[model samples]
Structures are given as structure tokens and as C-alpha cells.
Target: MSDYEISNVDPNQELAEQGSDNFWLIAAIGLGLTTIGIGIKDFFTSRKLKQEREKNKLYQEVLKKHQAQINELKNEKERREYRDRLWAENSN
Candidate 1:
């Protein structure tokens, strides 16, 4: 029998049997890897958002304390100025 001779008469059907199983196996592995990658990305994104929220809270607290100090200084300066004006007017 020659190497190219198949006992079956349908040439189109024999060609369809070549390497189709290998193609499907490779496609399934690729889909599994893509699913794992998306899961890992979501895990890291959630962690980063949590850290950013903590940092923002710390920054707000520091800003509030600085504003309080500024207001106290302004009030002290105004009191000093009023006292100086009163002393000068009473002496004249």
C-alpha cells in the first residue's frame, strides 16, 4: 500500500482529523491563564486602594492641626495689637 492511500474514500473527511485535538487543548490552557491573571490584578488593586485611603486620612488630620495653630497665632497677634493701641491712647 502506498503511504498516501487511505482505505476510506472520503479525502475531505480524512483531512479534518489532522491536529484538531491539539488546537483545542492549547485554547483551554490559554483561557485558564487569562482567568488567573485577572484575579491577581484585582487583589493588588484592592490592597492599593486601602493604603491610599489610610494615607489620605493621615494627611487630613495633619492639615486640621496646622489650621488650628494658624488661628491661634492670629488671635494672639490681634490681642497684642489691641493692647498696644489702648496703652497709647490712654497715655496721650
Candidate 2:
């Protein structure tokens, strides 16, 4: 004698109603998965770009240091050649 008791519901109608609601549930899950996929892809791509920029900066720094060392060696060689020339002239 409960007031909340349902007595004559058709099983086929209940199944059909459930099937209709399931469409929205499936659609929402699909959209969520696609969003996550795109987010992951973007994260990796941005990380790779950042790493490449850092590597390029390091390479440029190393190149600058190497050039400075080469210039110092050139200056030393020129000085040594000038000293040798003066010594030969003074000996004569």
C-alpha cells in the first residue's frame, strides 16, 4: 500500500527511454576524450619547441666562446712574429 509503488510499466518502453538517454552520455564522453587528446598533443609540441630554443641558445654561446679563443690565438701569433722580426734586425 505504498504511495511510491509503480504497477504497470512496459519493459520495452523503459529500455527505449534508457537507450535515448545513453546517446547524450556517449557523446559527452567522446568530446571529453577528444579534448584530452588535443591537450596532450599541444603539450608535447610546445615542450619540443622550448627545448629546441634552449639548444639553439647554448649552441650560439659555445660558438661565441670559440670565436673569442680563435681571435686571442691570432693576436698572440702576430705578436710573436713582430718580436722575431725585431730580434733579427737587431742581430744584424
Candidate 3:
């Protein structure tokens, strides 16, 4: 007979004596805590995203105003050049 031979002892006896340790209860508590942490992280992430979106909108509005001013300046310069050419042609 080898020392590693299988015995006829009940496998559940040791667990029963140790009160089974409520493994399912501990697992449920850990799962619930993990879910709450994920929810909190999601909430903060969405809030930051919203803030960034609003900032982008404001920047776009400012850029549009600047572009309009630049277009006005370009038009004025073209008008002056056209007027100068017409005056020179009439004098000649």
C-alpha cells in the first residue's frame, strides 16, 4: 500500500466542521461593491465630457466672429484698390 492511496473518508466532513464559511455571501458583497465603484466613475466621466463639449462650442463661436471680421477687412481693401484703379484710368 502506498502512502498516497485514496481513503474512504467523506470529503464534506471537513467543510461541515468549518461551518462552510458562507462563500456565496462573501462573493455577493464583493460584486456589489465593484458595481457601485464603476457607477461612480461613469458619473464623473460623463460630467467632464459635458464640460468639454460646452467649451468647444464657445471656442467655435469666437472663431466664427474672428473670421467675419477678417472677411470685412478683406472686402474694404479690395474696394479701395478698385477705386484707385478707376481714378487713375479717368486721369489718363
Candidate 4:
């Protein structure tokens, strides 16, 4: 018998052997890593949303205070003048 025979070589059999051995393990690890990444993404998204809500709440309170100050202005002219100044100051 010859040591190296081209007719005896089977590429499909070698591929099947390799695939059967590690396919499930590789698939499970990939799924686990994907799950972890999604969880981390969700956690950060929730944290950012909570921070935004808190910032909005603080902004609302400041806005109410400014409105009250503007309303207390005695005349329309003063109110409009102060309103313009307030907008410019806040925008900066």
C-alpha cells in the first residue's frame, strides 16, 4: 500500500469531524457573550435616562422660579425687558 494516496483523502470527513467536535461549544460561548453585551448596554441606557430625568426636574424647578420672578415684574415693559435679558443670559 502507498503511504500517500490522493484517492484516499476525504475533505468532507475532516470537515465533519471538526464541526461536530466544537460547533456547539462555540455557538454557546458566542450567545453568552452577546447576552452580556446587551445587558451592559441596557444598564447604561437606563442610567443615562435616569440622569436625564433628574436634570429635567431641576430645569423645571428653575424655570418655575424664573417665571414667578417675571410675573412679579410690575409692568409689561419691565417683564418683556427682563425676559429678553434672562433669555440671553441663560442661552450663554
- Which candidate leads the pack in lDDT? 2
TM-score leader: 3
* Clash pairs (backbone) in predicted model 1: none
Residue 1 of model 3: what lDDT?
A: 66
TM-score of each: 0.74, 0.62, 0.74, 0.60
What value does the lDDT take at residue 69 in candidate 2?
A: 100
Q: Write the candidate numbers in order of decreasing TM-score.
A: 3, 1, 2, 4
Over the stretch 1-92, how does candidate 3's per-residue lDDT look in tens digits? 65455476678888986665667777889999999999999999999999999999999999999999999999999999999999999999
Candidate 4 structure quality by residue, lDDT tens digits, 1-92: 57578678887998999898799889999999999999999999999999999999999999999998887765777879899999999999
Evaluated against the true structure, the overall lDDT of model 2 is: 0.95
Q: Native-vs-model 3 lDDT?
A: 0.91
Question: lDDT of all predictions, in order shown?
Answer: 0.91, 0.95, 0.91, 0.92
Which sections of candidate 3 miss by over 4 Å? 1-21
lDDT of 2 by residue, 54-86 (tens): 999999999999999999999999999999999
Clashes of 2: 0
Off by over 4 Å in 2: 1-31
